[model samples]
Target: MSQLVIQDLHVSIGDKPVVKSVSLTIKQGEVHAVMGPNGTGKSTLAKAIAGHPDYTITQGDVLLDGRSLLAMEPDERARAGLFLAFQYPSEIPGVSIANFIRAALQARLGESAELDATGYYKKLYEKMDLLKIDRKFTSRSVNDGFSGGEKKRCEILQLAMLDPKFALMDETDSGLDIDALRVVADGVNKLRTGQLGILLITHYQRLLNYIVPDFVHVMHEGHIVRSGDKSLALELEAKGYAWLKKELVHA
Candidate 1:
């Protein structure tokens, strides 16, 4: 099974240090949720691992099945089975969802290998049906004038179609309403059948209610200060980050 291993990771945006000394090993079939207050570097960690050009990895390494991800470009990382679901899905006007995803799937195939169209659409429709999305959505421009829920659902659609070994989901529930949150969560849960490892980054515990995490990690400032099971998220919901801060002070 493929796994993502992060070791002593340190990230910087320009001269400002963000993620500091964070490490995690996510094996397939596991869901690890990273929780923290704003500015604690949860998003930075995800972006850095995804090879976002803005963030620099000053120290440490992120590995996929023992290969360093830092050596690969963003597209290379995607093709290597590492996927990032952005907090904000970009608007690609005039590009139909079908064409965009088909292009991505095609790129994964080498120059010599051509994607079969009939097979691609068949798989795409099957995924859309599984997510209970209307088949007509395939013709719409990607996230162009889409509602907040629609944008998030689109991200989930891409996730479903790509079927990456490891997914770094950065604040997926950020702008979602309760109903949309459930729908997106249900789609993700359906895909979690021991073939993928997910790192779900969010600020609220509500997202955890539907997509229960196997491990819960709390980030303070720049490093992970605490980690536990699902109950830890409930605890965070009950006692906020300030409470964790107080505990850290006493520790």
Candidate 2:
């Protein structure tokens, strides 16, 4: 099984340090959730692992299946089987959804490799159907006029199409209503398999209600302060992060 390992990671943006000495590991078939209040660097951790240029890794190493990912570019990381679903997906006004995803698939091929358009569309249609997305969506501009729910579903469609070994989802439930949340959550649940691992980052515990992560980690000031089973999430939901802060203070 493939493995993603983060070791003593410290990340900074320009002069400000956001993530401080964080470490975690995700093996295929596991779903790990990272929850924290605002400004805790949860999103920063996700972006840094995905190799966003704005976030610098001052110390520590990120590895995939025993290979170092620190030197690779963002595209390189994707090709190595890492996927990051953004909180806000960009609007590609001129690009059709089919063309965008097809181009991404094409990049994963060898220099001389050719993509089979017929088979590609067949698989694409299947994934769209599985996610309950209409077939006409492929003709529309990527997320250009999509509703918040549609946008999140589009991200899930990309995740299904790309079939990455590990996925880092950043605040995927943001701005989604109950129905949208359930649809997105169901799509995610269907996508989870022995071949894929996921790191879900969010500020609230509601997302966990749908996805039910295998492990729950609490992040504070760039460090994962506490970790436990699904019950920890409920506990955190019952009592706010203030409870954890108080516990930490008294210890």
Candidate 3:
């Protein structure tokens, strides 16, 4: 099994410190939820690990399968099996979903290696069916004028097609209604059975209710403060971040 180790990571954006000394390890086939209120640096952690240019890793390291990710470019990090599902997926006009995903898969292959077109379509249809997406969706432009639900489901479709070793999903539930959230969560749940460790980031427990995590971590003021099982998420939903703040003060 592969592992993604984030060792005492400290991130800064334009010299403003965001994530501080955060450490965690995600092994394949596990879902770890990192939950906290907005502006707590949850997204920063994911962006930093994904090699986003705006965020700098001032301290520590992120390793994929025991290799440091700090030196790799965002695209290189992606090819190395680190997938970062964005909170807001970008809209690409004139690119069909089928072509876009096919291009990504093609990039992963060596120059001399040819992608088997028939096999690719076969697998794509299988995954789309598993997610309950309409086969006709293949012809739509990527997230161009899509509803919130459609955009998120498209992100999941990309995830399924890419099949990375580990994924960092930042606020995937943002702007989603109950029905859309359920559909997106269902897509994620279906993909959890392989070498696909996921670090699911969200601010609310409602998302967790649909997609139960093996571990739940709480981030506060740029660092991880608490971690436990799915029950911790329920506690957070009940008492809220203010209560956790007070408890931290007492502790």
Q: Identify the candidate with maximal lDDT.
A: 1
Q: RMSD to native for every prediction? A: 0.6, 0.8, 0.8
lDDT tens digits, residues 1-251, model 1? 88899999999999999999999999999999999999999999999999999999999999999999998999999999988998998999999999999999999997999999999999999999999999999899999999988998899899999999999999999999999999999999998989989999999999999999999999999999999999999999999999999999999
C-alpha RMSD of candidate 3: 0.8
- What's the count of clashing pairs in each model shown? 0, 0, 0
C-alpha lDDT values of all predictions: 0.95, 0.95, 0.95
lDDT of 3 by residue, 1-251 (tens): 89999999999999899999999999999999999988999999999999999998999999888899999999999999999999999999999999999999999996888889999999999999999999999899999999988999999999999989999999999999999999999999999896699999999999998889999999999989999999999999999999999999999
TM-score each candidate: 0.99, 0.98, 0.98
Model 1 ranges with Cα > 4 A deviation: none
* Superposed model 3: Cα runs more than 4 Å off: none
Over 4 Å off in model 2, which ranges? none
Q: Any idea what lDDT model 1 has? A: 0.95
lDDT of 2 by residue, 104-152 (tens): 9999996799899999999999998898889988899999989999999
